[model samples]
Target: MTIQFYLNGELRREDAVSPTTTVLDYLRVSAGKTGTKEGCAEGDCGACTIVVVRKNGDDEPLYEAVNSCLLILPQLDGANVVTVEGLARDGHFDPVQTAMVESDGTQCGFCTPGFIMALFALRQGNEKITDGTIHDALAGNLCRCTGYRPIVQAAHQACQDATKDLYGELSPLIPGEGYEHNHQKFFAPQNLSQLAEMRTDYPKAMILAGGTDLGLLFSKDRDPLEAIIYTSSVAELGEIEETKDYLEIGAAVTYTRILPYFERLYPSFATLITRIGSRQIRNVGTIGGNIGTASPIGDTLPCLIALDAMLTLYSKTGSRELPLEDFFIEYRKTDLKPGEFIKSIRIPKLKNKQKFRAYKISKRYDQDISSVIGAYRIEIDGLRVKDIRIAFGGMAEIPKRAVACEGAILDKEWVEDTALKAGLAVTTDFKPLSDHRASKDYRLCVAANLFIRLYRDLTDAEDLMEVVAA
Candidate 1:
């Protein structure tokens, strides 16, 4: 079987290629298109950034920046992909490239392609051009030599005119059919029944949604996944529905796509989601994938657990719904049965008198994993605490609620003394292990402090997200 896609408006059919081959390798070795550089095969460094242009429901083309290093050859099946090489036309530099040249954006020249591609996506978007937006777009692309002043100037230069290009100018093309090569199979199922049947057939097959985490297996760990059932192609799993009760986010919905609704409905939670990854990561990372991985330090887990979210698991046998909290059985383990995969997550919308806030303490400000992610949702009546839910990631073997601490503060008056007691009660929760991220003591200490921050953030108008200027 062959994988089909459009590269620079030209149709590409790839056969006899290894299923586990990263797009970075395919671009450099097989295709001889080396414009997309590979600095960190782990997708941290955006040196391998590329643009994927596809059609949305409205028949309008959407161009998104993705890390080629983290992309498997099969993920591009039936999609349109553009690398740095595709940006030029008739020997003329794209606006982004022209701007970069004028502003001296390239110094070492290795990471320039990635920066240009990232900026290209920004230029094509209908966003307000600001330093913050530009910075967020380029956060994943790191250039040590250039202080980023020139690159930002280049972004400004490119956006001075509305970006019009060959990219997204044509109608979107449909994705390719499934393929199998050398005992490895890549399945792209369009409907839930097809997905469920595929899972039933390939019990141990890897379920890949956004490939943010699963892509690391092949990129970094070199795991040649024998069979992969990609959920991103499943229309049902990719749907996002809003109801009177909850926000039903399909398992395949990327963080970038769901962010706008989150921003409108859950601002604090949206802020935390922004911190989950850089714009590049979020472009392909899904919240359902986050829940499926069941990682203890998952950025969204703390928020989901605190929100009292529910997971809908689908299998060939049937479908079941369970509390997100109950989904985690232990470290890196979930209650999901064989042939079962996460279908969707339903998060209840905040209502009148309900307040929610999430705090993340990390070693760095941007694109770094959390040392501790604390999410809190509380309901208050006057000075009395009516109801509260608290959850933390990176403070235990699983993203868990501080049940004892919640008990300590429940129905208590919102005060410093009350917060102190609840903070101290955090010890009753799981004992976090010491690792490179933080020490056990540090985790516990921050866990206690977050409750205080959450209280202050909820009671007063003081922004916990703000950094005090010097």
Candidate 2:
């Protein structure tokens, strides 16, 4: 089979006999574009970061930063890609490269290319970049040399040059017919029906999306996955729509696109999303992917359960929607059947009278798994709780709803004594196991304390004097 795509502003094609070949291997060995380094084969490190620019229309292009290590070569069949080596124009360094040189950003240079590519996508058309923006833009790239100050300074400087074109106008790098291989085949289906049919035909095929999680199998586990099926090319899986009652997010939608909607509807959830991964990870990872993985410590699960989100699953048989809470059976297991995939997620819009909050406890503030996560949604009728939903993660074999605690809180008066009592009842709901990140006792304590915090914030006490006096 012949796999072709644009590489470094050139049309490149390769012949591979096996579908197991990864884009990282193809680029370094077959295509000889060594600038895209492979630091941690998993998507954790941004050493393999590259920009995948696809045509939305003739006027505007959609650019996203993705980990090259996890991508199968066939996924790039018709898309245009920009690598670190392609950033320059006419033998001149791009503005980002020039700024990095001026700011003394490159020390060891192993991570330089990845950082440059991240900044290149981040600074594409922006006129000014602030410290916070630079920090967020380069969050995925890790510098072991600890030379972050200069690199951040360089990004800021690159943004100041408004007249300079950091990314020049270039044609899409589409592969040609000259390349041929017999053993491997790549399929990119444009619609959901086509994708479903292909999936039904090949149930054992490896499905590739953002590769944030799937990429780890190759890099860390060193497992070879052949018979690859690429999902990014499917248009139906990436749509986002807002209706009168709910927000619908397609499975292929990236975290960057959906974060703003989640922020507007659920502010507390936005904070949790930021901690799920770095900016680059967010750019490539999808909400559906997070739900599909069904990890015990998945940060989004608790919030999704609290929001009463619905998961829509599609297969060759047909389409069905189920509450997200019911989709998980245990750690790393979901209710999805063979040849079936998640289509989209629907979340209800909260009303003004409703109170909602989410909390994540982790050893580090960002780029770490949750030690314990709690999400609460409550409806208050005057001074009493009309209804309540409480969800928790990292407290059991699966992320679960604390129905016992919810039962205790619903219809109860909004008071400190009641909240404290309800918090204790939550401990009886689940027995968390000890892990390296936290202990069973700590998880229970934090879970209860989070509920108390939420109650206090909602009640709005007149003063701290009452607590002090008591």
Candidate 3:
């Protein structure tokens, strides 16, 4: 197959013979662009961050940062890509590079390229970049030197330069010709039918979207996935639509795109989504990828379950929709049949009287796995609970709804006593196992306390004081 795309203002194409060839490998070896470093081969580290520009129409391009390691070679077809080395022109540093150098941002400079590209994507008009924004922008890039203060300063300084938008005139990078590899072949399907047909024909072929999770197979598990199908070029899988009743999020829609919608609908879940990974991971990681991975500790699952989300699965035969909870079967397993792929996630709009909240407890504030996560949705009529849904992750073999706890809180008034009793009832639903991150007892206690906290906040007694003699 011939992979054709724009590469750093140049139209290029490569003949790709093997499906196992990654975009990172193609960039470093074939294109001789080594600025994109390989930190974790998996998407955990943003050392391989690169900007992908897709033509929206004839005006400005739609730019996004993605992990290069997870992408198959064929996915580069019809797209424009920019790497760290491509930022400068005529042997001169771009504003971002100048700022980083002036600010002494690079220590062990391996991760600098990724950071530069991340901040580059974040730059828009003359907007004032806040400290929080800088922190969030570079969250994916890990500096071993821990010298983030200067790097963050560089990001702020770069935004002030007028030359920041010089790259707007640069030509888009495009892939060229056929690539040769070992035995397997890669396919870049353009339409949904082509993707479905390919999947139907090759059920065992590894489906690659934003390689956030699938990339881990190469680094951590060391699994050899030769036959590959890249979904990045499929236009239909990337659509997002919002109607009066539900929001339909396509399977390939990245977390960065969905964050704003989730924030508008369920504000509480936004915090958890922001901390799912780093900005680079979130930029490339799809909600569908998280659901497809079927990890018990995935931060999004509990929240989605609490919101009563539904998933649409499509195959060559037809499409089927079911509640998100029904998709999980057991540990590291799902109910998806052969040749079927997740199409989109449909979440109903919250009612006026309903409340939704999500809480995540991790060892560190950012870039860490969850020790335990809890998401809740409750409906109240005057002081009595009309309905409630409680879901938890890292507490069982799968992210599950605590039906017993929900039953205990349903029809009950929002009060401390009711919260306490309901919290205790959660014990009947899950007995969390002890792990290095947290003890079983600690998880249980925290799970119960989260309910109590939610109840206090809902009742407007969150800061209640108790009189004591001291």
Q: Clashing residue pairs, candidate 2?
A: 1-181, 1-182, 6-173
- The TM-score measured for candidate 2 stands at 0.91
Which candidate has the highest lDDT of all? 1
Candidate lDDT (C-alpha), each: 0.87, 0.79, 0.81
| Predicted structure 1, TM vs. truth | 0.96
Q: Please identify which of the two predictions, 2 or 3, would achieve the higher lDDT against the true structure.
A: 3
Model 2 Cα lDDT, one tens digit per residue, 1-470: 46666776677665643445567777788878899999977766788888887544355665667778877666667567888888887888888899989999875657989999888887774424788778777778888767699998899888876664524244444432222245333456677998898789878876667777886776566655545566676888988989889999988888877887878888889878887778767877888888878988888888889989999999988999999999999778999999899999998888768877989999977677899999989999887999888899999988899988888788988777778877898778999999899999999998888877887777656643576468
- Regions of candidate 2 where Cα sits further than 4 Å from its true position: 55-59, 125-128, 164-185, 459-470
* TM-score against truth, every candidate: 0.96, 0.91, 0.91
Stretches > 4 Å off in candidate 3: 55-59, 124-128, 162-181, 219-224, 461-470
Q: Cα miss at 466, model 2 (Å)?
A: 5.2
Weakest 10 consecutive residues, lDDT, candidate 1? 461-470
Q: Tens digit of lDDT per residue, candidate 1, span 1-470? A: 78888887788888999888998889999889888898988878899999887666686777889999898998888788888998888899999999999998875657989999999999987789999999989999987664899999999999989846756364345665588888989999999999999999999888998889988898898888789999999989999999987899999999999999999988998988887778889999999999988999899998988888999999888999999999999999999999899999999988788888888899988889999988888888897989899999998899999999999888998876788899999899768899999999999998898777776766555432342321
Alpha-carbon deviation at 112 in model 2, angstroms: 1.9
Candidates ranked by lDDT? 1, 3, 2
C-alpha lDDT of candidate 1 relative to the true structure: 0.87
Candidate 3 lDDT over 187-231, as tens digits, reads 667678998998998888888787777776654565656567767
